[model samples]
Target: MLLALYAALGVVALPRLLSQVAWFERAPRLAIAMWQAACASVVVSALLAALAVAVPASVLGHGLADFFEACATLLSHGVPFTSASARIALLLAGVLVVRITYCAACVLLSARRERRRHAEMLAIVGRHDSRLGAMVVDYDECMAYCLPGRHGLPVITTGALRTLTSAQTAAVLAHEHAHLRGRHHLVLAAVRTLVRAFSGAPLFARASSEIARLVELLADDVAARGHPRVHIAAALVGLATGRVPDFALGAGGETALVRVRRLLDPVEPLRQRERLVGILTIGVLLAGPAAVAAMPGVRAFLAHYCESFIF
Candidate 1:
């Protein structure tokens, strides 16, 4: 019986398990880590339950009646619902729900609220031009940030505007344009969701930050691809790692280190690893659920009872 449960869990959780390890060992970024951890939590919890139960399958044959009989007999010893295994699952699910809820609140409060805040602040610093883009200077000791919405947020500071050459200004504009064009802020919000979703899991925070950095890299590429380096360089120096107001556009923020490094020396490549290792990790993770699913009795239980447990 224990074997049957473990096997079933392994099958059901296999895909998620493999994905967790694959993402963790590979990019080790935030979104990937969150997913890996969340999935890993459920699968690992099940594995531990299986270990505790130590059930012995009473019947094994091609016959359906035998499968049902054995399952019934083994479970009658101690139904899984009241077992320690079920308790682990219950705890994990509760924690995950809280984590996801907190994450959503953070994003809604952080990036989403910033949009409204900017709308009010913009009237004082910059005017809206549907075609030319909006500009502002925010002195709030925050790093310069540009987020996209119905209209583009293009922030230029009194200091930055005063310091940079027109060429630099254009370069800065190009960089922010990249952010607005690519919807980088929304991507960051999504990454944040991934980050908080797996708050208790290892490497999840690093992965989320990496994803943010990657988006910045992507934006930098768009801004600098066809322009003179000096302009963007000047812009980065002007932005210089301060917190631009939440309501304004700035050339840099969380990704400042990577951007500076790339600007200084541009040959860095994305990390690559042995595909086989990633594949195996993915295989192990994926096996978690599929293994569970493959057991007919477990599947029946899930379909009839446990499905309700899934949020």
Candidate 2:
């Protein structure tokens, strides 16, 4: 029951709390990890809460021998739940698992189909540029993005080519390359799955949108490592009006103005101690639920196995 309450509180509170923190803008990568961890924590706590009701604490205390015997009996005889609460708890856990799995499959399949269609379109209308290492489309809209996958590649429009100077173009391409190289699409896909699975859940919805924005900031940081920040900012400004397909990760989007400004006027990043604290927080968010769920089983195992041992 406590675990369920924790999950509920996290769903309602984490988004609001995390969003209010200013340090996230200075360290987008760390912020992304924190958001992901928070989501994972809620899911794990909810699942474990249901399982706790279905499985008796006494069975866990008896250690692995008894636990395995119970499992074997369950498998061999298909023993029915002894209580209505146990039956309902197991049903709840199973439904949550199946829903998430189904949603994940849907998100991945839809993204794959969209990418395939977009790839085919690109092959027809775009030509590869060896010097720039990107697919050049002859459209009159300043745009740049990457198609991420096995044959992932950066893409640019002729309009952007004419608009941006050589150095600025390099910066923009670098940003797209960072997205491809980092496999950031998979990260987006995972968050999208959560949002789809939970539909109107505020935590998943907010996390998905915020992570998408943070991803852009992260890519800009990567691009800045290889190119001048000013060049990247200038390229973003030039490509601000352009749009890319939903399947593609683009260099410019609604966040372009904010990203451009961030690039031009950099803020001080988290200090070493602050970063360490953030890392610890992420660890706790990820592991806290599992530790809570395992405490009874662990204590049981220790008692059964170490009863005869001397300290």
Candidate 3:
């Protein structure tokens, strides 16, 4: 029940709290990690909560021998739990796990299919440009994006080539390259799965949107490392009117205006102490639930294992 409460708070409270924090823009990578950890922590807590309900605390207190014996007996009997509540709790845990797995699989498979189709289309309409290190489509729309996968590559349109300067074009390509190299699609997929699995949940929905925004920021930051920030900002502004397919990671989209501004006037990265604090926060988010769930076992280890060793 305690673990369940924590999970509930994580789902309902964490997102709202994190959304209000301004540090995310300055430290997007850390922010992404924090969001992922929070989501993982909530799921784990829910699973642990159900397991806690299904297993009697007294069984743990007795010792490992008793714990194994009880589990074996249940397996042999083919009736997992004598108590209705325990059976229900176990079933709930199973449902949560299955739902999340199903959603994740669906999101990945769909993205893969889309990417393959888009790749086929690109092969038909686009030509490789050695100078640009990207496939250039003859389309008049100014755009740049990456098709992410094992064979992922950056893509650009001739319209954009005519519109951007050499430096701006390089910056845009760098941004797309960052997306492919970082496998930012996988991060987006994880959050998308959560949103699919729990559609109306504010945490999952907001995280999906926020993480989507953050990834572009992260890509821009990576691009800036190799190219001038002004070039990145100029590229973003030039590509602002263009759009990419839903499955592709683009350099510019609806968030382009904000991203351009951010690129032009960058904030300082998180300080050492602040970065350390963020890392610690992520650790707590990931470990706190497991620690709570293991309290009974920890107590049992001290009471039973320690006593036997001493004797």
Candidate 3: residue 51 lDDT (0-100): 90
For candidate 3, list the clashing residue pairs, or say none. Answer: none
Candidate 2 lDDT over 41-80, as tens digits, reads: 9999999999888988768778668878996898699999
The global Cα lDDT (0 to 1) of model 3 is 0.89
* Every model's TM-score: 0.55, 0.92, 0.91
What residue pairs clash in candidate 2, if any at all?
none
| Candidate 1 RMSD to the real structure | 9.9
User: Over 4 Å off in model 2, which ranges?
Assistant: 62-69, 241-254, 302-311
Q: C-alpha displacement of 232 in model 1, angstroms?
A: 1.7
RMSD of each: 9.9, 3.4, 3.4
Instruction: Compose the digit string of candidate 1's lDDT tens values, residues 1-311.
Output: 44345544544554344444433322323334344443444435454444334332222213457666755875687555546664665565456567777887888677767787876677676655444364665444423456468765876655665666667777777878888987777656765675666564333454455556566666666777767765677678766634344565454453565566566666433345544555455565556554543465454545654455674
**Scored by Cα lDDT, where does model 1 land?**
0.56
